[model samples]
Target chain A: MFKELIGKRSAPSKNVIERGAVKKFAEAINDPAPIYIDEKAGKASRYGRNIAPPTFPITLEYGAIEELVLPTKGLIHGEQKFHYKRPLFVGEEVYGVTEIKNYYERTGSFGKMGFLVIERQGTDAQGELIFTEEQIIIINEAARKGMPV
Target chain B: MTAMTEIKVGESLEQMQMPPVTRLDLIKYAGASGDFNPIHTIDEEATNAGLPGIIAHGMWTMGNLAKLFTPYVEDGFIEDYAIRFRNMVFIDDVLTLQAVLYKEEENKREFKVAVVNQKGQEVVNGTVVFRMYEVGMAG
Candidate 1:
């Protein structure tokens, strides 16, 4: 099912990485690092402004993969990796795009499954690449086939 | 920042454990990560999807692994982190996150990272690469 998407890229979705969103993300992760939420502490640090947590870019859903839709049910996040040119800062306007990297089928204890690899790239307003997240998602074909759970 | 001179290969960093992965935690993560997939928050939805029950977001589990580095280095110093989700994490499962420095180059250090549930099942496995910077050299 994912065969047609390989090498296909989604349209760029623009976003404003806001401080409030960063705060909510930090709070949700239970990471209370001052640099992520406290502006005073941030200014005193090397970044000179509030920064988002390292994994905060995962929150920019609408900003990436605007047109790439995959089966959501029975899908398991297989693996994830993030490469950063630098820490994403608050108040930055960025755009992200998703590209299908690869796909394959494998058999497991549960049964036959399909693995889909998708990569998301975030770029600043100037179009400089900021960070890229590549994730592998597994689809349980057995479950989708109405086989025994 | 971890003083550039203090880092040594073959040494282990302090191990950290996260609080139990609660159902509420998943809800909070869904809101925070903008990944409100039903399987992560609603048990019935997960059951319908043929899962045991609601599962934690893989990014959340990955973040818990990344959180281990926060105290050792300066804020926002993580250059690269990667993880493979090996097993599903269920509610009430307390995860242990650990990292050990195993390799060193001119300035970069490589650490092996892993997270295990209360029963000692490996939930996540990965590596982190951070190149130490001279104090005041960070941007």
Candidate 2:
């Protein structure tokens, strides 16, 4: 089941880190944390710069949908984890790369599906590695009543 | 919109890492996700969840990982990325995440990456793919 699936890779993306985008993202998360909106408010917070809510730039960080697309049903939001070195602030130019690491076929309630994982790394304008994420997506196999080894 | 043209393989960029994982961070994540499963807030809830102590949300870690892609060429950024919630990172878990060039040029773009805890345990495992130009998009 894990054999048919192989590997792939991709290039990096860049951003100017528009502070406003970060604000919208914060609102999306409904974070009441002031650091994400007001500079003065941020000064009073741990991170001096207006911060960005985690996962705020994922979709934007990765240029296109195909980068992470693995067609499957019951596409559910599984689980997530976070490790912060420092809070992300608004208006900080950042860049990163996204690549497909691996994949395989597995059986589940929905039947046989392809399980794949993708990773992204965003570094500040100074070229310092900041955030890195690896997302897992499972794509269900298309119906083919009788076709297998 | 052409500015967000596309990103190719081998290109690289960066962003900032969160300050540090804290108990408060977990609580904030809990509020955002509405996953007040308790384990993220109370040690008792964590123990009941079969965890070491108060644990953070798996999604929080994933969200942190996603922030890594914010900086891409104009029409740049992560097309998509995902991971399996493998290990648990506690309050003191200082994390360092990175993705070096694993491989490219395949019909399928792929890269190898990982998130490590202070103890050097791999808390999460996964990959990311980028598309310079989406294969299918309507103007």
Model 1, range A54-131, lDDT digits (tens) per residue? 788888853434345655466678888888887788999889888899989888797789888989999999989999
* Tens digit per residue, CA lDDT, model 1, B1-139: 4543465787767777788888889998888788888888987888987788888888888876777676644522667888898998999998888888888765567889999899999899988887565533333
- Using DockQ, give the best candidate's number: 1
- Residue pairs in candidate 1 whose N, alpha carbon or C atoms collide under 3 angstroms: none
B39-91 per-residue lDDT for model 2 (tens digits) = 67888766754568876666667666554443332222344455666687788
**Highest-scoring model, lDDT:** 1
Stretches of candidate 1 exceeding 4 Å from the true structure: A62-68, A143-149, B1-5, B72-76, B135-139
Report residue B61 deviation for candidate 2 (angstroms): 13
lDDT of 2 by residue, A1-149 (tens): 32333344455677766666666545433343565677787676544566676566453554443434432223333443233344455777777666666676678887786666666667787878777766666555652222221
